[model samples]
Target chain A: MRATLMYGPGDVRVETVADPKLHEPTDAIVRVVQACVCGSDLHPYHSMDATTDGVPMGHEFIGVIEETGTEVSSLANGTLVIGTFSFQDNTCVFCRDGFQTACVNGGFFGSHDVPGAQAEYVRVPFAEGSLVPVPDVSELSDLIPSLLTLSDVYLTGYHGAHMGRVEKGTTVTVIGDGAVGLSAVLASRELGAEQIILMGRHTDRTDLGKEFGATDIVAERGDEGVAKVMDLTDGEGSHVVIEAVGHMPAYEQAYGVIRPGGIISRVGVPQYEKAPVGFGSIFGKNAAVTGGPAPVRAYIDDAIPLVLEGKINPGRVFDQSVALDQVADAYTKMDSREALKVLVKP
Target chain B: MRATLMYGPGDVRVETVADPKLHEPTDAIVRVVQACVCGSDLHPYHSMDATTDGVPMGHEFIGVIEETGTEVSSLANGTLVIGTFSFQDNTCVFCRDGFQTACVNGGFFGSHDVPGAQAEYVRVPFAEGSLVPVPDVSELSDLIPSLLTLSDVYLTGYHGAHMGRVEKGTTVTVIGDGAVGLSAVLASRELGAEQIILMGRHTDRTDLGKEFGATDIVAERGDEGVAKVMDLTDGEGSHVVIEAVGHMPAYEQAYGVIRPGGIISRVGVPQYEKAPVGFGSIFGKNAAVTGGPAPVRAYIDDAIPLVLEGKINPGRVFDQSVALDQVADAYTKMDSREALKVLVKP
Candidate 1:
């Protein structure tokens, strides 16, 4: 089977790898029909982790179940499924409480011992809790993009918006315009946010934001950006400030750009090994800040339905598509901010 | 009028200051009947603020309405009232929302424009908002402590416990042993927290914690304190962590000492300007942290009722008393940690 592997920083290659086979009664072998590069994938791609040899990459996918273990009952041969990026055992106390992402035995694909979906075939563990069946698709053309998003990006944006407590009539200010940020725009809108401000520079980024329902755009950074957003709200700031960029600047800008009793949901993985926090700023305003890796499995049940129903088109995020062999090219384009989301065909 | 004034660090004196008059139409001239020195008083008593010239001090007080402006309708002559430490216009958005201490026009006693209560008379602004009427008590001793705390410490601790969402049967951990922390112990127990831990070193303080409702105590500091708490929880930490000490070490330990999905309410005013936040730690665990100046006006309603009913006995906190002329001795005693709460009589 051909799979995408990271050899080192900026080095992604399509190479023949071991064929995925059922190794446990709770496992299922899936012939991946579609896959895409993810924002998180760029973490290792741009960092030292990309230098690791033969590390299989990619987590998002929609595929057909080629085989199922004896313990698997909900899924069967030919079942079209969306496998969430993180695997979880539904029986855990955390999972039972709707926090499956924090499940005791949860694991992220493409990290450490977990193999990824940028392959001809992949193994899904805890199949019962990991896979969501795609009910019906109005058109075949929509399957790839929608399916590609279920496992990571789209679900992540939904999770981010959810954490921000975005609701109808909420005025949300998204601090980043990355794929997750754009997805947040869609998610916020879906969740009933009346107005959203996409704070970014590039025309390409704002265009995507507009398509997803960003009512305003602030191309400035730091104080100016906060000022622009504050100006938009009569100086009260946004009701919700989504810190999509997990860094000091965005974190600082969020508090400055939000109202006294606002909410800031941060889902971005911090680059600094020890991310700095500002307690005085956060406590002073009586605001709430919370986020984490999207519990894709928890969101897929809803996001997958939206995609299949054609009510949402998260697949439009992919501005370009490339062969598995062109994985490195995809990384180069995304790292340079030239592309929004890229689809990788195995 | 003779008022408690700070001449220099650790130097307090009772001197004649200008008698307060009707500063605003809504202001009431209250003849202070009972006033107490708070742990926070030590901040200025032992701080640079004390080294300054003529700093008026004292926030906690119970008083008689000596005079009321024409527009003041809430009380009449000779009405007994327990004034909130911070004056707020109850009609403002923050006060209407139950955050009176943070009202836009809110004024804290003893700091600049908000005159301290350790005087013969105080200019109580927004009289309707700051005054809580209590039923007459035959035992004058039973009423002073409750009235003193109404201004700051007790209500602040109650607010802290409330913010942490501590409820009946929930386990609670209070991280500071100041007056507010001691008050939090009472608040926790009154609110029905099953087990309360008060982390302190002084025998008097620990005993006070127990008398108030602390079920356990961990005298260790930093990592040792956190480890002891974790051990107390069988390594799961408490369901709620009340951070009363405002510093990085205590703040960090507060986060480390809580289990997954715990609530951390930081009411302590951080001394180091700004403390770096633990973003990932909070997000990954689905935790929440919030709090600021106690909305004294908000909790006074609840606290005053508890006091009148004798459901909560906060009067025990005042371990000593002194004549108003001995303000200097009062400051010195509290600064040396020899007293938990001090009362002053005019």
Candidate 2:
């Protein structure tokens, strides 16, 4: 089986590796049909130290269940399925509360212990809870890319808007121009945000954001960006700010462009541990800060219908696609900003 | 007019100051009936630098309207009223959104410009918006203390519980057993929280907390406190943590004791400017941090009925009282922890 692996920073490769096997009664063997490079992958891509034993890569994927453990009662082999980035029992108190990412029995894929989805065959734990079975899409194969996004990015964006409580008449400012940010623009619109402001420097991405429901785009960064957003919002900031970029400046922009009593939902995996939250920042305006690893498993059921019904086309974010053998090129393209997101066919 | 003034750290004085005069068409002069020393007052009491000019020292008060400017039509002279700590023209967008503390034209009363409430007469700006008229209470004079608390402490506690979304069947952990914390216990009970855990070392205060609504009291701090709360919740942590103590340790305990997907509503005036908000803290659990100065004016209307009917007795937090000339001793008693809170009559 061919699998993606990272040897070190800027080093990505596809090499023949042993096929994943069922290790627990709750596990299922998934024959990957599609997987993608994530922006978070870029974090390790830029700074991961050299290692002789390469790290498995990728967390998002849609596949067919090749084998199921005895304890996995709800799912069957050969069924098309979407696995959330993090595998969970989905019955834990936290999972039941819509925070499957924090499930007591859950663990994220692509870690050293749990080989990743960007492989020919991947082992999914808590199969019944982590994998949502999709209807026979033999003829509706075109929906694959969109369904694949529900594994992570799309749901992450949705989590931002959902946590921020974006709704009708809300003015939402989405920070970052990446796939997640664009997805947030779409999610905000889907949630009935009256105004969508996309803060991004990339014209191509911002243009896509506009198409996705961004009524305004602020290409500026930092102070200028905040000023422009405030100007657009009539000197008051947006009612909700979706922070999709994980940088410190993006966090600053999030707090800056949020109106008094508004919410700043950050889906970006933060790059820094400390940020100002004192009287000078969120406290002064009574702003709330919320968002974390999206409980994609919790949202997958509802999101699948939206994608199946063609209400959203989150798959458009995949601007480039590559064969398994060209996985390294996929990473290079995404890392260099040549591709919004790269889909890999195994 | 006699007023309480903080000349420096450990130096409080009762001095004769010029009677407040209407400085804005929106202003109203209120003759103080009762004003209380707050937990926040201790911030300056411990660190205030010596100066030739003293800072006015109180913000909570219920009083009779001595005079009303031309624009103050909704309120009349001689009417008993409660003024929120921060004065705002409640018509502002933020005020309408239930965040009057962040109103564009709002300013706190104890600042350099606005004389504090611990005086014979205090000028309240945005009178129509800041003052909530109380029904004739001369016959029910006992309710004055409680009504005065609605201006700050009690409302601050309500803000914490409200922001934390405490409701039926929810488990709430309240940090700090100060006036605000006790108020939060009361507020949590009022909001239908099924389990209320009050975290404090003071038995006297915790007893008051229990009386207010705390079902459990944890006299521990730091890791032990976290362990105790986790143990009490069957290792799941509380559904909401109301941070009533504004220090770093309190903030740390807040994140520590919250269940995944819970809310940490901080009403404590944060003493620090930075805190960790990365994966190791709030983000890891999908916990939200929300709260700031209470928009008391927005809540005063609903709270007035509760206090008027004797359903709550927030004024019990005022454990000591002082006359206009004894205002200096009020601060000393509170500063020394000899009194939980002190009510000043001017």
Candidate 3:
């Protein structure tokens, strides 16, 4: 099987790898139909050390179940499915509470023991619990790109909106311009936010954000960005602030732009080891701060219908597509800002 | 007018201060019937320096309106009322949004210009907005002590529950056993929580907590305390964790006990300037951290009715009482933990 592997920093290659097998009765063999380079993939791509072993990559994918183990009862071969970034047993107390990302027996796809999604085939554990089948993939064929996003990005954006308590008449300020941030803009609008403000400096992304229901844009960063959003909100700040960037400064921007009694939902994977959440930071305004890895499986059931019905088009975030052999070019293009997101065909 | 004044660290005196008079058209002069020394008072009570001027102390009080300025329309002379820790116009954007504590024109009770509640008389700014009048005080005379608590502690507790999203059937863990923590136990019950856990080491306070509706009490500290709570919730953690202690360890305990997707509402005045809010700390669990100075005024209307009807007895937290000349003794008893709280009569 041909798969994308990361050798070291600034080194990526498409190489033939051993095929995955069903080692457990609960597992299923999935033939990858479509996969994409994710933002988090850049973490190891930019910093893989000298002695690091080549690692297979890609966590987001849509596929067809090529084979199913004896214990996998719900799914069958040829079932069209969307596997979330992480696999879950879906019966743990946490998963039952809709926090599948924290499931007791969950595992991520590109782990050392698991084959990555940017390949011809991958083995899925807890197959029935880990997969959400598209009811009629052929009927919804044209919505594949949008449906693929539910595997990670769009679901994450929806999580941000949901966490921030975005709803009808809510004034929302999204503090990022990346694909997730743009997806959050769409999610906020879908949640019926009265005013959607996108804070980013990129003309290309901001233009897309406007099309996605961003009523206003603030290109400034840090304090300046906070000031611009506050000015637009008549100095009271937005009712719901969605923090799509997970760095300290992004968190600071969110704290500064949230109105008293408002919520700041952060979805970006945090980069810092510690952040101040003391009286002066969050307690003074009676604000709320929450966010984490999206439980995409929990959300897929509700979000897929929206995509299938054409109520939202978060798939537009993918601006370029490349063959599996061109994964390196896709990375280079995304890292250099030449493309919003790159879709890969296996 | 006789008032409690802080001249230096460990130096409290009963001094004759100028009687309060209406200063603004929206002001009202009130004769305090009851006042209490707050936990926050200890901050300055133990740290006043040689260069520091004498500052009047209390902020919690129930009183009778003595006079009203020309523009004060709603409150009449002799009206029995509860004055919140801070005074606000109640018309600012923040106040309109139910965050009266951050109102544009609001000010605390113990400021240089405003007389503290420990004084015989206080000139309350924005009288119509700052005071919640008790309907037919004579009929509810026996409930005065509990009504007095609405000014701060009880309201603060309610704020914690509300911020943590306490609702029917919620499992709540209160991280302190102080008056506020016990009040949170009571507030959690009022908010319809099914199982309430109080985490503290003090037998006396925990007894009070159980009386206030604590279903369980965990006396451990640090990781042990977290483990105890996790054990209580089937190793998943509580649905709403209310942090009533204002220090770093208390915050850490809150983070440890909150279930994934749970809320941590902290109302304790923070002792530190910065606390960690990183990925390892909060993001991975998808938990929420929120709270601040309680919007006591916003909750007064609903809470007061319950207190007035003798349905809740938060004033039991006031375990000691002192006359005007014995203000120093009241401080000593409360500071030494001999009393959960102290009521002062001026």
Candidate 4:
């Protein structure tokens, strides 16, 4: 089996690796049908995240169950499924409360001793709780990207909007023009937000954002960007602010554009060690800060149907696709902003 | 009229000042029946807050309306009312949304030209919107202290619990031993929390917290404090953490004790300029940070009845009393920790 491995910063290699097998009674083996290079993957690619030698690299995938362990009765071989980034036991206290990312018996894919999804075949722990079965479709060529996204990005976008409490007739400002940000725009529209503003300078991303139901676009940055958003909101800030970029400036921008009593929901993997969440910045406005790793498993069930029904086209973010051997170029394309998302056909 | 003035850091003086008079069509002049030193007042006294020469000090007061401007219709001469720290016109967008602290065309008491409530007679702007009237009772001697708390501390406490989303059966951990922290314990009980823990060091304050419905008290500081709280909460942490102290350490304590998806509601006037709200600290836990300056005016109506009925005794925090001439001594006592809260009779 071939898998993507990162030896160090700016180092990515698609090399032959040992195939995955059942490691636990609750585990299942899945043959990867589709996966992608996530923005978070850039954290290690750019050397921003600590990485050891030869770590398996992906956490998003949709696949077919090839085998199952003795204890896994809920799923069978040959079932089509989507798996969240972290494998969670659904019965854990945190999982029951919709915080599957913090599940007691679960941890992230590609982490220590866990096989990643960016391979021909991968072992999925806690299969019954971590994998969501999708309807069997005769042709999956078009649905693969969208289904793959439900494993991470799409659900993360939904989580941002949900945490931001975007409601009907409310104004929403989504910072960052990445795939997740565009997905947030789509989710905000799905949640009935009356005005959706996408803050991005890129024409390519903003074009997709507009198609995702963004009512406006602010090309400015920093204080200028905040002023533009405030101007659009009639001098009061937006009712809900989605922070999909995890830098200090991005957080500051989100805080700056949130109206009094509004919420700032962030789904971006934070790049900073500490965010200045002070009373002078947030308390006087009575604002709130929420969002983290999305409970992808919690939203996958509801989100799959939307994609299945063709109500949303989150797959549009996949502007580039490549074969397993070409995965290295895919990372470069994404890193250089030449691609919105890179679809990996294993 | 006599008022407390901050000539500089650590310099407080009780001096005769010009009596207040109606200045706006919506203004009213109130003869302060009672005023108290707020925990926030200590900010300027301890040199943590910027102090200017002769700045009148105080924002919490219960007073009798002595005069009303031509446009003041809801409140009139002789009405007893509790004034929030800031005066707000309830018609503003923020105020209508229940965030009176961020009201437009409104500002805090003791700010610039705005006279502080800790004087014989103070001019109140936006009288009808800023003041909550108490039922007139002939013998009001015993009810004065409790009603006075309605202006700030108690309402701030209630705001913390409300923002933290304290529900019927959740566990609540309040971080602070000040008047506001004690008030939060009382408020959490009123909000129907099944288990309440107060984290404080002082025997007197913790005893009062227990009386206010604290089921447990963790007297440890720093990591030990968090460990004690985690041990009490089945090693997961509390469902709701109330940060009644405004400093960074209190905020960190609150962050340390919150469960995944839990909320930290803070109301203490933040003395620090920035707080480190990192993803490592908050996001993975799926926790939230909410609460600000209490929208005291918004909760005053419901809270007043609680105080009037003796359902809560926030005034018990007032362990000492002083005449108007001894207002300087009041600040000293509170600053030196000799008094939990001080009551001033003008």
Top DockQ prediction, candidate number: 2
Chain B TM-score for the candidates in order: 0.94, 0.98, 0.97, 0.97
Alpha-carbon shift of residue B13 in model 4 (angstroms): 0.7
lDDT of 1 by residue, B171-277 (tens): 89998887888888999998999989998888788898999999999999888998999898877678888888777777778778775657788777656644434
Using all chains and alpha carbons, the TM-scores for the candidates as numbered come to 0.90, 0.99, 0.97, 0.98
How far residue A292's Cα lies from its native spot in candidate 1, in Å, is 2.1
TM-score ranking, best first = 2, 4, 3, 1
Residue-level lDDT tens digits of model 3 in B1-346: 8988888877888888788877889999989888888888887777767435688888998899999999988888888999999899999989999999989899798877996888888889999889989858852476888999999999999999998889999999999898899999999999999999999888999998999999999999999999999999998899999999888899999989889888989988888767766667778888898999998989999988787677899999988888878988888887888888988887
- Model 2 has a DockQ score of 0.87
Candidate 2 has an interface RMSD (Å) of 0.6
Candidate 4 residue-wise lDDT at A139: 24
Which wins on TM-score, candidate 2 or candidate 3? Answer: 2
lDDT of 4 by residue, B1-346 (tens): 8988887767888888788877899998988988999988888787745455678889999888889999999886788888888899989899999999899888899865897877787888999998878747432569889988889999889999999889899899999999999999999999999999999999899999999999999999789999999999998899999998888888888889899999988888777767756676788888999989888889988877787788888889999999889888998889888899999889
CAPRI category for model 2? high
At residue B250, give the lDDT of candidate 2: 98
Best by TM-score: 2
lDDT of 3 by residue, A267-320 (tens): 888777577676677788888888899998888999988988898999999999
TM-score of chain A of each: 0.94, 0.98, 0.97, 0.97
List the candidate 2 regions with Cα displacement exceeding 4 Å: none
Whole-model Cα lDDT of every candidate shown, in order: 0.79, 0.91, 0.88, 0.88
Estimate, for each residue in A1-346, the C-alpha lDDT of model 1 and write its tens digit.
Answer: 9888888878888888778878789988888877888877787776764344678888888888889999999887887888888888877866775667778888778743668888888898888888877645421455667677877887788887887789998999998888888888989999999989999998888898999999999999998888899899876678788878777799889888766556778777655433433445766656666677777766676666676677998777888888877877888888898888888776
